[model samples]
Target: MLITIGIIIGLLIVAYFAFVNFYPSFGGDVSKERQSQYTDSSQFEEGKFKNDKDVPKDPTFSEILSMTRKFFFTKVEKGRPSEELPNHTVDSLSLVSYHGGTRLMWFGHSAFLLQMNGKNILIDPMLGEVPAPHPLLGAKRFNEELPIAIEKLPKIDAVLISHDHYDHLDYKSIKSLKNKVNQFYVPLGVGVHLEAWGVPQDKIQELDWWQDTSLEDLRFVCTPAQHFSGRKFSNGQSTLWASWVIQSETESIFFSGDSGYANHFKEIGEAYGPFDFAMLECGQYNKLWPDIHMFPEETAQAGIDLKANVIMPIHWGAFKLALHSWTDPIERVAIKANSLGLPMIAPKIGAMIELNSLLANHQEDWWD
Candidate 1:
């Protein structure tokens, strides 16, 4: 009887490890494309980037364990039921003029399509069923229907990614979007995943901190952000994180990718700020991971740090990544921004927000 019990226990442990070992591609050095993206670390160590089980576990695993325990064992909060989405159809809104003006349309979460100087750019698009490859883990996306399906989007000029977090760069989203994107502008080492996922080498443009590239009248500058990067546990901090400055002759826009409170905001503000409009990170924050994601109030502070005239809080209203209520982020930020005299745009799931209109009359409480 003892031998039978031991044998059963041993098989179960083996099966668990096997399950962990086999999963969505880790984008590690496997395929030829992935190998080509590898940079020698002299400091490089083998098995530095892969899924969680094989990598160095977090130093504060106890904290993560405690949090997970509380979430499963104790956390039981209810979300207030929102109004049923109004009956509507996607509008065929024609472009007014791209002479020198800029406009932004949110697709919920951090996916945005920015039109300026007759070009379209997408930022940090996590358009997939789940942020992670598996549906069982990671937060579910907020709006099941994207603002517009990727097929309906106009010809895209460039795609900007801030980091390699599952929430920021999704594999299925990239695979679905592979052939359509004209150029992929990413930070150093992020090209590995894109390459692994089949983006052509020529299409992947990797830049370091403070690097700038021009596409017609607009320029994209990769600036630093106070954040870390990792798709799997093995590669924590192996790649760079950043914010981007998009500039044209008459207007400038700042896309604050996922970041924590860092003095880097001031540096970026000094370099390419006084922006006409800035899309800042404003949700999925918690005291546990405070260094990576900013709370609602800090989102406002970040706007001030960037010298932005008008700010639109993003990274919220899309997915429930933290323990807060669905409306907590927007509600809290709305109040703080008003008190601080900061302008904010609180649009619905897929509303078109005109830059000129936002700068003119700013009282569209569309979230209600």
Candidate 2:
């Protein structure tokens, strides 16, 4: 009986190793050539990119064992929505025809369609059904359907990726979008994955933190976010993670990709204040790793720090990456926003949110 148990355990370990190694969705490595490009960056030391602030210390072996045990044994009933999440379908033709103003559409989680400066921009578009390299490895997305199918999307001007995490930068979505998108703007070291996935080198522009680039009238500034990145276990921190400052002549927007509360928020506000809208990450958080993902209260504080005219909580209403109740993020953020007198909006997934009307049409609690 003991011999049989050992044999089964060894096979399981070998199978898991093979799956991670052989999976195309695990993405490509950051080559030595790519690492060379980041030599001048303060965040790049030795080989891997480093966070501006110190991240939480790596979990000890004992902590890892405890976490693994708890993860499999713990009962988590409220971590996901009970029923299929409702989402509105976007009219692709109308979206393509839209002009004269800035509009934003949230496809749940961090994926967004920003129609600005007469251009269509996608940010962190992880539109896959699951947030892992394989479907069976992670929680499924909450919605049955996306607002618009990938095939139905309008010609994408640019796709901005924050990091290479499966939840933020999906391989399947990238493969589908590469042909449609005119360009991709990503953080330094991230271009390697796109290159591996078949994006033309000319169409990809990689930037280190604090670096800014312009495509026509729009300016994209890669800024810092306090988070870690890795698709598989071995390549952790190989790519950069960032928030972004996207500015048109008339309006500026801040996108907090995924971050914990940090002083960088105030620093960004000081540098580029009075943003028209700020999309702050506000979900998939827990007390065990509080320094990596912000709690909902911290989300409100981050908005305040960014000096945003209106704040829209994102990184929720899609996937259950943490142990909290599915609706806890929005509920907590709303309470904090009210207390702080911060203007906030939580639009239903797929709603066409006119940038000017964020404060006026803010009270729809569709998650209820």
Candidate 3:
């Protein structure tokens, strides 16, 4: 019986490997020449991307085994919402007619729509029903429907991708938005995946850390994030991860694309901060991997470090990627923000928020 169980486990491991490595949805291959271009970057070394700071030693084989065992054996009943969370949908047609100041719409997790300088921009647009390569293979989205259907979205001026993680760079969402997007802005080597997905080469702009690009009146600076990247195990860290600074003439916005608490936040603040609004990751964190994701308190602190006037906690309320209760992130973050006297907003999903109005009408505790 023991021998039979071992054989079955080995076969399952091989099958899982084959699925992730060969799956088209996992994303495109990075060529040797493409990797060479990244050699000049401080974060790229030994042919793989490296974090700004060294973390605790990579999880040991025994530690990994223990975690895997617990994952399968543990009962996490509150990890997801019991019912579909409520959301407000916006009319896409109205968005096109009103040429106005900066406004934003959240679609749960890290996906957001930012309208600034009369341009519509999408950040980390993983709009599909699942964060995996296929809907059948992984956890489904917490909500059964999106606030706005992909086909109904207005023409996107640009799509910004922070990394190639399945949750942040979804395959189906890219295919759906390809024809409608005028351009794509992504971390270095991430353009390879877009190219494979039928996006035009001329439409993709890849940037290294601290590199800035312009799209009409908006200036985007690809900043650092303390995180790793990869869709498949074999191609781990072949691409870069990042945070972003989106600046218009009158306002600056910060988007913390998946990161742990790090000094980089302070450094970014000094360089290009005093932001009008900031979005910080505040969910899917675990003690085992403390170096990659931040606790809710850390999320609040990160906003202060970025010198943001108002902070909005994101990266929660959409998926069950961690063991914490569905409401833990916002609940904890709200407490931390209050204790620190940080002005924060937990906008209802799909609520259209204007940047100028943030100071006056941002504190709506819709989750309660």
Candidate 1 has what TM-score?
Answer: 0.84
Error of 1 at 133 (Å): 2.0
Q: How many residue pairs clash in each candidate?
A: 2, 0, 0
lDDT of 2 by residue, 184-262 (tens): 9999888888888889999999998889999899999999899988888788889988999999888999999999899
Number of the top-ranking candidate, with TM-score as the measure: 2
TM-score of 3: 0.95
Sequence-dependent TM-score of model 2: 0.96
RMSD of each: 4.6, 1.6, 2.0
| lDDT for residue 154 in candidate 2, whole number 0-100 | 95
All candidates: TM-score: 0.84, 0.96, 0.95
Model 3's number of clashes is 0
lDDT of each: 0.73, 0.90, 0.90
Clash pairs, candidate 1, are 41-44, 142-318
Query: What range of 10 consecutive residues in model 1 has the weakest lDDT sum?
Result: 47-56
What tens digits encode model 3's per-residue C-alpha lDDT throughout 1-368?
Answer: 99999999999999998887777798887899888888899999888888978853477789989887776567786778788887888787877886988999999999999989889999999998889878886889988888899888999999988889888999989999999999999999899899988898999999999999998888999999999888876788889999999998889999999999999999999999899999999999989889999999999999999999999999998988887888999999999998999989888888888898885665766665
lDDT string, candidate 1, 1-368, tens digits = 99999999999988755654575445533344443454543222352332212222355888878878765555435332254332123442453234445777777778887877788788887777577657887556655566567666666789999988887888887887878789999987788788888999899998877889999888999987767777665457677678899988878889888877778788888888898888888877877777778899898988988999889888876666677776787888888888899988776656656777775544666556
Which residue segments of model 1 deviate by more than 4 Å?
A: 1-22, 28-58, 73-100, 359-362
- Tell me the deviation in Å of residue 206 in model 1: 0.8
